[model samples]
Target: MRKVDLLDELRSEIGVVSDKCADQVNDLYQFVCESLQKKMPGYQWVSIYLVQDYAFVLRHDEGERILPQSIPFGEGLISVAAARGSMVRERLSGRVEVYMPFYRGHHLIGVLVVIAKRANVIDEEDVSLFMELASLFETKVEKYNS
Candidate 1:
């Protein structure tokens, strides 16, 4: 499917989930993680990490490999993205990691990390879509937290 189509589908689904489960932000995250992982080919891992006090706690994820449950501030790429309040994209030999930060108003709140097995799997368009997705996630977060 096209990237815009995928995002539209996700946004619609997230709207439904938001209407039904407005207080359960984790469920919304889970739906997004699953939908993106299944619909978007080449995505090896899709995860959302929410800020909890001093660290980022894993909220929802869908993938084959295991990942850390939490990451502290100023530690890893995820934290770097959050601290910088911007998206971070890293391309390695075989994989590409995109970390898109989410915020509550002006304060950083979380990060959405997408990992693809190959560097070519993600491009500029994909990053833009992910940024929108992250914004949607942030909106839901604020909706539920308010």
Candidate 2:
């Protein structure tokens, strides 16, 4: 399938999955991982890092395993997103880091990071889709925390 079609499918599936998993935390993470694997085939890693006490804690992840699931604000992609309250896409030779901020009103809640094998692969469409997905995840997290 074309990249655009694949992205659309991912976005639609993410929305459906988010709605279906709204009441459950594990389900939401599973859906996100599945969607990322389907949408960005070259992504080597994907994770959701939540903001807690002004820091980012890795709440969920897929692809390569990572330990120490927490990082201070301004340490990595999650921190960058949380600090800026915007999407940050960076490409470095063989790797790509895409950070999407999750916000409820003006408060930044978390970030979603997609690490791909090929640099410069993330596009505008991907950013838009990621933002939508991040918002869904944010809502779920907020509801779960409350």
- Candidate 1 ranges with C-alpha deviation above 4 Å: 1-4
Query: Mind giving the per-residue lDDT tens digits that candidate 2 earns over 27-123?
Result: 8777787678655778788888777896788878888744258888778666667678888888866788888888766787777788888886777
Per residue, candidate 1 scores C-alpha lDDT tens digits across 66-141 of 4589888888898879778899998876899999998889988788899998999898878877887788777877
Residue 33's lDDT within candidate 1 is 89
lDDT of each: 0.83, 0.76
TM-score of each model, paired residue for residue: 0.87, 0.83
- lDDT for model 2, please: 0.76
Find the candidate with the highest lDDT and give its number: 1
Model 2, backbone clash pairs (residues 3+ apart or across chains), number: 0
